[model samples]
Target: MKKSLRFTKISVLLVAAISMSLTACGSTGPKGGAAPVQAGDESKLFGLSKTETPDELYEKAKKEGKVVVYSPSARANDAKKTFEAKYPGITVEVFKLKSNDLMDKLIKEQDAGLFNADVIITKEVSGAVGEEMVKPGRVYKYLPEDIAPNVDEPFRTKDGYANYLEMRTLYYNTEAYKSAPVSSWWDLTTPEWTGKVYLVDPLSSPAFMDLFTGMVVNSDDMKKAYKDKFGKEIELHGTENAGYEFIKRLRENKPVVLKGSGDVLDAIGKAGTKSQAVGVAVSGDERKIEDDGLKVAPIYDIKPKTSVPDAGYVYMAQKAPHEYAGKLFIRWMMGEKDGKGAGVEPFNELGSWVPRSDVKSKNAIPYEKLNMWTYEAKGFYTNSAKVRDFWIKLK
Candidate 1:
């Protein structure tokens, strides 16, 4: 639901290679432009909390009084309240911003030699999170040993584990249609939906941009979906593959392009709108159906996939002032050993899916059963610019 970008694959790999070489496995890099954290010697900055019990970390972190958090979701405030209620003496302060802004602020803080944030939960998987923050040693991955196993493998990463998986996919007005109107990605290119589909410009959103790049990388799936829909092999016109060709035909249909998910939803989600409009939206925003009284629902089984699944990730800050508090908060936020912690309750809403396999969502729909695919981060990181340009220059 959050982030911004423009990058390429070979360039991303090359830069990562150079950064790794310079940092010597992230042991020798500038700690956000402060002191160098020697590879094996970061224990002082790393703290002893990783190996300690939650009770031990909680006791130590309680003494610190508070932990600072930077996150893209507003729900962190709910977590903050529940956490305070559970722990009493300890407190959480949340800084809510878009992922791009959050990452920029973190980088700037590190560059300025100030390390104030104790924890961060945001998303920019292919761009700022992996390549910009984790690889540069600006953040650290902290998985509570007791709870890690409950998380699905797809949600785990070397950088850190995701707190929740979010879908960048299709949403339609329920008031306009009784059921899903489009059954495939290729359906959007058809004449029936011309000028009736709404999309957030990929150039403005990393999630949408990466979703397109993912299509290019896995264009075979797009080709197959195309043929299955139209009963003929697809033809590409000055494009890389069926992915670009899909974009071409969809663009020719004159879809309305907006600036954000909220805007796109607002355009199509109103009641009594005669137009049978579909919008590409963040699934997490599906809550608007209740919150704003918009009758929108996700098309969870769109052929070839429902969406490019991304996530909201939680990461510990490097040299955090309240390291123990940071670790304890992460443990709590991950829903503890059994996935019943109050800290995760606020996030167990209808639109989002938690990473913990043991945690059942409050809503009925199981995202695991939906048609979703794991996107390629390396390709998303680098080749997204190609997708962006294609959109920009498409006639």
Candidate 2:
């Protein structure tokens, strides 16, 4: 009888222990549960309060000893060196890859329960990051107090993460056209530009697709530009919006489509080139003109607009092993350490405009001249599929 009583007691204790363990796991929240963060509580958990000082963050970050970043730019390596120098003993490791590849790798690694990356920086925030990662709670949105006030609302997402702008403009061979050949976007579709225009294949580049979508979203502006240029209202060509009509017309014009922007730049910018092609590529590609002995310049003084600005976003991983370090790195990257922090130096090389009001880009075209489009995460995520389908059908 005594032996039977002892066995019952042991079983009861085992059950009590299991219940406690389950309770503990349940109460530990998203980090431990691998669930989406409670909406209102994210800032409290990921961001430093106004009262919290940088020294406090540094202490926590130093304890992690290292941070791993996945980005599409080799410029990340420059930021890594700057970050390490700023915080001795905390190492920064970067994995550079194309935007699509970076997203695939992160998703695959996260699925395998390998949270190797602490931070991810890429141009697909509106598409891949918003739809694939942020919506699913695979990453955390963090905005440092130092940077929060400096950035405008439109430049960031609802969650407080920043999106840095990259400008794309039309480039013309300086020798062939002393002045810009096209004054307005409509000029690209005219008979003179039928076979002389160059651009990346929209089906292959999400950035280029985003540009098209931006035009669609701003159809009113497109319509106005059309009226201003041609002295008449735009006649939609089997499409509801002027942007789509413009895209249809431009595509029909048979512009040279290339797989990559680099090739587009080469074809349009190479010195002594016989082709008088005007290509749309990253504004920063101007850095290559002199190096390649090409006399190419963007139409910075165009009437309605010169270029479109697309933003790249940065986010911390949901279950980052070095959460504090990731926060520190992001803060540093946003120019938080000092007014002109080293963390932002590499990005400066790309001539991309940062969201910070205080920081200025050294690109040839001024920020005001560019038609900047602040990325709307939801709009881009929802409209990308429809746009892609349209592009495929048109192509």
Per-residue CA lDDT of model 1 for 184-254, tens digit only, reads 99998988989989999887777887777777777899999999999999988888799888888999999
Clashing pairs in 1: 8-382, 9-382, 27-39
* Model 2 residue 316 CA deviation in Å: 1.4
Error of 1 at 194 (Å): 1.3
Off-target runs (Cα >4 Å) in candidate 2 are 1-52, 111-113, 156-160, 301-308, 365-369
Candidate 2 residue 309 Cα shift, in angstroms, is 2.9
Q: Any idea what lDDT model 2 has?
A: 0.68
Query: Among these predicted structures, which one has the highest lDDT?
Result: 1
TM-score of each: 0.85, 0.81
| Per-residue accuracy of model 2 over 186-276 as CA lDDT, tens digit each | 8988998889999988776677877787777767878999999999998987897987887889889999998877788888877787458
Which TM-score value belongs to model 2? Answer: 0.81
Error of 1 at 78 (Å): 1.5
Per-candidate total of colliding backbone pairs? 3, 0
Off by over 4 Å in 1: 1-15, 18-51
